[model samples]
Target: MSCDGDQHTMQSSDDVLPPPGDIQVLLLTLDSVSLSWSSPQGLIGPQTFRVTWGCDGETSSTRVKDVHHLKISSLKPGEKYQFNVATEGEDGRQSRWVSASLSTVLPAPDQLTVDSVDTTSAAVSWNQSPGLDHTQHHYQISYRCSGTEPHITTTSSPSITLCDLKPATEYSVTVCTVLENGKQSQLVLTTFTTVLPAPDQLTVDSVDTTSAAVSWSQPPGLNQTQHHYHYQISYQCPGTKPHITTTSSHSISLSDLQCGTQYSVTVCTVLENGKQSQLVSTTLTTGSCPEGWRRFGCSCYYLSTEEKSWEESRQDCLERGADLVIINSEEEQTFINGFEPDSYAWIGLTDSVTEGTWKWVDGTPLTTPRYWWSGEPGGGTYQNCGEIYYISSGQGVWRDYDCTFSQQWICEK
Candidate 1:
C-alpha cells in the first residue's frame, strides 16, 4: 500500500505545470499596456495562462490560450499597477504566479484656455494634471500660424505667455505633459486669433483748397500681403460732421473739403470680423489766403489803405512782392468797381510811352471792350497815366491822368 501511494504522488507531481518565465512589459501608454512572456520549459499539455492586474484596490483577471502576449486596456492614466501571470493545465492544476509592476504615462493637462490676447502676444494656461508630482514633470508647448511651421518650447509652470505672434491671424497651440522618465501624454490642441494692429506713420501728404491726400504705413512686423483688413480714415473740422471712408490701399484722397480749415484726421485698422485697432491721428490745414487779403477766383487782392503818386504806389506794390491790379475781364472790373465804390485808384494802364497809344503795365496793348470813359484820353499829351473814377451815374470808368497824381491803388498777386 505504501509503494502504490508513492507512485500516485510522483504521477501527481509530474502532471503539475510550471509558471511562465521572463514576463516583460512590451509596450506602455497612458491608458494601456502590452505584456509578453516565454512559455514554461517542456511541461505544458493543453494549458492556458491566467493574467491578473490590479490598481488602487481594484483587481481584474482574464485567461488566454496558446499565446505568449496579452494586452490590457481601459486602464487609468498615471497610475501604478500590479500584474501576475500563471499557468493552468487541463486537469485544473496550476503553477506559481509570476509578478511584475509598472506605471502608466502621465495624463494631459486639462482645461486649456487663452487667458488674454493682444496684437503680438497671448497668455495661455491649463490645470495641473491629477496624481502627478509637480516638480518631476514639465509641459511642452508648440505654436504656429496658419499654414506655417511650428515653434516649440517647454515650461515647468502650468501657464505660459507666447510672444511675437502675428496680428489678426489665426494660430494653433498644442500642449502636452512630459514626465521625468521621458514619457509624454497625448497632445491637447487649441486655437485663437490675435487682435489687429494699429496703422502707423500717419501723414497728410498734401492739402489743397478743397481736397487732401493722405497716406500711412502698415505697422511694423505685420505681413500686409497676408492680411485682408482695411484702414478706416476719419476727418473732421470743429462743429462739423466727420467724413469717414475705407480703403485697402495705403493712401487715399479726400475730396470736397472746406478751404482754409483745420481738420483732425484719424486712421485705424479694421479686421474682417469688425474688430478695430487703436486710432493714429494727425492734423492738416487746407490752402488759404493770408490775413488782410481778399480771395477771388484763386487770386488774392490787397487794396492800399493810403494814397500815393502813381510811381510811388507802384513802388509800394513792388516792395510787397506784387504788381498793380490788371483787370482782365468784365467780371474782374465789376468786382474791383464794387469793392471800393466811387473811389479813385491808379490803374496799371498807361500811354506815357506814346501819346494816343495805350498799353498795360505788362506791355500788352489795350483792346476794345475797354472801361475807358466816353471821351477818355482826350488829354492827348497832357495826361500820361490812367486812373479809375466813378461817374455821377454810379458807373466806374477809366480816365487819363497826370503822372504826379496821388490816389489809392490795388495790388494783385
Candidate 2:
C-alpha cells in the first residue's frame, strides 16, 4: 500500500492556514474603536477567529466565528493600542497572528460642578476622566450669553474661577479637557446666573416723633430681566438688634420709633429666587424731644437733679428750647409723680405777675376750681412760685412756695 504524491501534499496543506491581514481601523469613539480587515485566505467552513488587544501593559482577547471585522473594547483614550488577530480552522489548525496599532479618542471629564458662585465671579471644579492617569491635562473653558460670541480661557488645573460677569445675567459655560498632545475631549456644559446687585441711593427723606421715611433708587444700568425686584429694609436703633421690613415701593416708612433717637437703616435687594443683595446703609435721626427729654402727651419733659431757685430752673428750660412744665389735668399731675418721695419739683405755676392770683408762666390762669392743695395759695405774696409733691405722695397737688427757694424742677416743650 503506497500513498500517492498528490494525496500526501494535500494532507500537509490542510494542517495549516494563512492568518488575517491588512487590519485597518475604520472609526474611533470615546471608549471603543472599530476595526475592518481582509479575511484569512484558504480557510474552510466552521472556522473561528482570535483577536487580542493591549495598551500600556494591559491586555484583553476575544474569539469569534468567521468575522472579517473585530471590535476591541476597554481601550484607553489618548493612547496607542497594539492588536493581534489570527484565524482558526475546525481541524485544530491555527495561523500566525497579525499585529497592528490604533489609538482611541480622548476621554471627557467627569463630575463638573460649580463649587461657588457670586454676583461677579464663579468657581468651578471637575474630576479627571477615566484612563487619563499620568497625563498632563489642563482645562479650556468658555462662557457667553445666549446668541453671543464665547469667551475662551485656559488653566493648568481642573478647577477655575471666572470673574467680571454681568450681574443678574444668565450665561452658558462649557469646559473641555486637553491632553499633552493637544487632543481635546467632548465639551461639558452648564448654565449660570449671576446674583443681583444692591439697591442704590438709599437715603432718609423725612423724620417725625415716632417714625422716619426712607427712599431708594433702583439699581441703574439693569436690563428688563433684572429690573424686577422687591426691597428689604432693615433698621436698628442700636446696631446689635435689627428689625426688618419688605416693600415693593421705592419709598417706605419705618414706624414705632422713639423720639430723638438715631437709627441706622439698611436696604437690600430681594430677587425672584429669594436671594438678597449686599446691604446699603444710612443713619437717620427722628425729630422729637432732645436727647435727655422724654415726651409725654403734647410736650417733652426733663427733670433736674441739680437743685436751683424757681427762677433759675425756669431760665434753664428756656435755653433748652423748652419751658417750665404746666400741669392742666389729673393725668399730667400723675405723670410728674414718678420722682422720688423725698423730691419736690417746680412747675410753671406762679402768681409772680399779680400777688394772690395763681397763673401759669405762659399767662394761662388756673381757671378750674380745686386745682390746688387744700387751703393752698395761702402764702399770698411771700409764696409766689408753685411746686409739686413729685413722688410717692397721697396727693401730688401743688403747694405755693417762695420764688427764691431752691429745689429740683421739671421742664417741658
Candidate 3:
C-alpha cells in the first residue's frame, strides 16, 4: 500500500520531514515478518528508520540508523500480528506510523501413517496440514533406519513410497506440512517395522545312510539386517519322529538316521525377531549301517588287531557278534590273501573231530573242490587248524597248522 512521502500533518518547525511511503510486507513465515518502506523526502542527511510492531496487545519498537527495511523475527507461528513503520529525519523529526496486519503460518501435518512394510520397501501417507493457504501445499517426508541419520524428500501428493529398506528392520518417519507462504508445520513422527523375508533355495549337499549334509541361503533383503542368522533343520523317516537341529551356520550335517531309508528334510531361516521364514523342503535317502559295523559289498567286516590262538581267535570273533573268516570262493581266497600280506591268519577250517574229515567252524564239511596247498595237513591229526600262509608263495594258500598257534584274524559280521 502507498504512503505519502511529502504529505504530513501540520508542524510548526521550519524544516518539516516527509512521511515514509510505499510500505510493504514480504517474506512472512510462521515465526517472523519483514517490513520495507521508502525514506521520507524532506530529510537532508542520513535518517534513522524506526520500525514499531504490536501483537496480542503488547507493543515493541526497534530503530535502524541507515537501512530502509527491517526484518522482525521471533514471532509465534499460526498467530495474528500487526506491524508499523515510520521515518525519523536526521533533524529529530518523526513521521506517523504506516501499519500492516498478518497471520503466521499453519499447523503441521496430522495423522501420519506408515504402512505396507516389507523387506525392501514401505508406504507412507498423511493428512493435509492445517493452515490458511493450500496453493503450494506439500508434505516434506523424512525417514531413516532406526538409530541412523535421516533422509528427506518433498511431495505434494500427501503420500510417498519408501524404498531400499531391509528385512526385520525398524524405521522412523517424519512428515511436515508446508503452504504456499513457505510456512512449515510442526513435524509428525512415527515408527514402522518391516516384515521378515522368506528363506529359499534349499539344497541337500550330500547324504549317507545315517547322515546327511544340508545347506541353504538367507532370504533376500536380509543380508545387512541379519547380522546373526539361525537355521532350523528337520528330518524324519516315513514312520519316525522328526529330528530337529539348530545352528547359526547355513550348512548342517544331520546324523543318527536309519540307513537306506527315505527321509524328508526341511530348512528354515530364523530372523532376529525370532520369526521363522517359510520352510524349504527336500527328500533324500540315508545310507545304512549295521550297529557299529561298516558295510562293503554284500557283507560287513570287522578286522581284529589282537593276536590270539586259533581256538581263542575263533571264540573271540564269535563273542564280538561275528564269525571268523571263511573262504568260500577263489575270489574270496584272493581277497583274504591280500588283506593280510606277508603274514599268517587263522581261517574257520579245522579237522579237530576227524583226522581226514575237514569241517568249517560253522559245521559245514570241506568237499573235494578245496582251496588248500598239496602238502597241507601233512601233520595228519595234529595239524588240525587251518590258516592262510602268505610268506612262502607269490599268493596266499590255505595250510593246516596247529590249533595252539597265535596270529591276528579277521571277523565278518
Q: Which stretches of candidate 3 lie above 4 Å from their native place?
A: 1-111, 127-134, 218-226, 237-241, 259-264, 271-278, 283-413
Candidate 1 residue lDDT tens string, 1-413? 01110111111223267888978999998678999999887864665887778776667777788998988887766668888877877775767778899988778999999999988999999998765643378999999986889999999999999999888778999999887766788899999988877888998887655678899998655665776688899999999999899999899999877777899999999877788888999999876555766766645577888888888888888787567778888877777776673368887888888887888888898896588888877676768888877554434889888878788887765
With a 3 Å backbone cut-off (N, CA, C), the pairs that clash in candidate 3 are 208-287, 209-286, 209-287, 259-287
* CA displacement after TM-score superposition, residue 328 of candidate 1 (Å): 16
List, in order, the clash count of every candidate structure: 0, 0, 4
Q: Which lDDT tens digits does candidate 3 get at residues 1-413?
A: 11213223322333245667767877887666777887777566777866666665656677777778877776666657776666676666667666678887666877888757877789988776644342456778888886778888899876899988767778889888766556677888999877766566788887645677888776776664444678788889887889887887778888776767899988887756677766789998765434655554444555567778888998988887568876677766666676653377888888899888888888998874476777777766578988887755345778888888778776664
State candidate 1's TM-score. Answer: 0.50
Which residue segments of model 1 deviate by more than 4 Å? Answer: 1-80, 85-105, 133-135, 203-214, 223-230, 236-242, 246-253, 259-264, 270-278, 281-413
Candidates sorted on TM-score, descending: 1, 2, 3
Off by over 4 Å in 2: 1-103, 146-148, 180-182, 197-209, 212-230, 234-253, 256-267, 271-289, 295-299, 302-329, 334-413
Best by lDDT: 1
* Residue pairs in clash, model 2: none
By lDDT, the better pick of 1 and 3 is 1
Candidate with the greatest TM-score versus the true structure: 1
TM-scores for all predictions: 0.50, 0.49, 0.44
